[model samples]
Target: MRIGIVNDMPMAVELLRRLVVSTREHQVAWIATNGREAVEACRRDLPDLILMDLAMPEMDGVEATRKIMAETPCSILLVTASIEANVAGVYEAMGHGALDAVDIPSVGIAGNASSQSARLLTNKIAMIGKLVRDAPSRASGRISVATDPSPQRLVAIGASAGGPAAVAKVLSAFPIDFGGAIVLVQHLDAQFIPGLADWLGQHTPLPIRAAQEKDRPQAGTVLVASSDDHLVFKSAQQLGYTSSPKDNVYRPSVDVFFESAAQWWPGSVIGVLLTGMGRDGARGLRQLRDKGHLTIAQDEATSAVYGMPKAAAAIGAAVDILPLSAIGLRIIEACGRPT
Candidate 1:
């Protein structure tokens, strides 16, 4: 796959350049020092993908991504270095149409900064390549739903990076009586999510409904987080969507739902982090794990991009790392199944 790298830092630009060179299937088509250059290059060359940096000097990645997507239309993968102190900015970039993100490794940490940087960058590049080249085509495969329905506990799932197809696979695997609530957060456009929810619901037994401002999460139904607002749970056992201050990078963030589950149901909550491109669910999953709630992540093999799951695993936030098919069964088992 041909890719473009956009970053103001000379070291980061060189690092990414080497990474793309080493990857057998990927090539760096062009390198832009700022968002303005990125936009111009994208319009000129139209690379297959872009590795964007959030904090550029002339123009930021978010605006550039918006322009590139509108005019040139290519997949964008954000690469930044400040996740510990500034994770929220990453999500803002995503909201502006950047597909996913990765942390830029510290320069000169290993024996060879160039090679180490390349190795780290290579993994992310390959994943983005998969998303750019594989997801749309692969989304057409028949989704497999689970057959048994004796379980009683419902599970709510929310994610962003690489989530659209991953959520569908897990939902499609459950049988009609899987016995629980299934809420989702896919970090998609508000106007289009209703249609996406409907499309995803067609493959699952539990019909997908958009979550109203004060609706309660009920059993045997799949409730999706509303677009343009954050979905949280109140002490009254009701779902609340508010325009309150955003906590993490993504407003309808996985952290909000997973953290709420930990608070609302404690041990009864089942939180699953699927293929995504950031750390949105990592902290919330940790909270769930600490509270003895069930936490799971989609294993690397089946993930369209494993960023979110990888983040959860890195922090010991997940109790299990399973493939897409096994996640639904794990949910059923956690909800207490016939097995």
Candidate 2:
């Protein structure tokens, strides 16, 4: 893939450059020190993918991404150190057509700098490449259709690093009246909970809203995990949104929600782990599979960040590992009439 990287931090630039070189599937098409230069570079060269930094001098990544999307319409993956602090801005960038954001890697990890960076960069490049190539058309293809007569099955979704766009793609494919409660756990900040919900609501038919404390799962709605809260299920299928005071490092943790649903919903749940950067959902999805629930992992071919789902698949957690486009159909089929 032809790639462009735009960031002001020399350390970040070096790390990403090393990673890109190691991937071998990617070529650094351009390197810009700021968003203005990034926009100009993209406009002129039209690289297939861009690794954009959120904070930079002389125009921010958001505006530059907007302009690049307007002019060149390529993929922009945000490489940032402060994803928690910029949830709203990141969502805004995704809404403006930036494909995904990844946490900036530390330069001091214990490995050969170039080789390690190259591996990291290669994984990200491939993930975002697929999302950029596939998500736009998938988003455009969403429609509301009548649900078939099947048991009331719930949709369980999990995501991480570049999950926002993937989550939007899956949900936007369904109508507001799509039969089943949709529970989503995306690693995000408590501060940007409202914005994330609101942003997704504007693009999908389902009422994308934050999961309220003690609320129950219901059909015709999409429930997002609140910032800093692990959305769990209580007795009789009620929602439990509470601070995760345990050892979990991820707020709005996917593992907790997926595990809780595995216990509470049992055979009726349909679990999905989409594009992400970590293994948080792997164990939980495994639990769901043990309980006879149907589980699906987004295949490497259609993931923006394949870490989470790939991890799940590695553990044999999924009944199938399919592309992004086929996932909605699988969910619809799961909610369809019995044979």
Which pairs clash (backbone N, Cα, C closer than 3 Å) in model 1? 145-173, 146-173, 154-180, 154-181, 161-276
User: Which candidate number would show the highest lDDT if scored against the true structure?
Assistant: 2
Question: What is candidate 2's lDDT per residue for 101-217, written digit by digit as tens?
Answer: 667775555533444544554665676665444332221154444653332677899886557767777776786668777889887655566878877887687787888888767
Please give the lDDT score at residue 305 for candidate 1.
50
Report how far off residue 221 is in candidate 2 (Å): 0.3
Local accuracy by lDDT, each model: 0.70, 0.74
Q: Encode model 1's per-residue lDDT on 1-339: one tens digit a residue.
A: 988999998878887776677657878899999999999997789887888988888898878876775576667877877643334455455544466566776666552355555565676566556555434321102333344343234486866654656676687777665567677877654654666666677678677888887776666788888766777887536788766655344657778777777787522678888866656778888998898777898887776555677778888999999998788767766665432
Question: Where does candidate 2 stray beyond 4 Å?
Answer: 1-32, 35-89, 92-151
User: Per-prediction TM-score, please?
Assistant: 0.59, 0.64
Give the runs in model 1 whose Cα sits over 4 Å from its true position.
1-152, 337-339
Best model per TM-score: 2
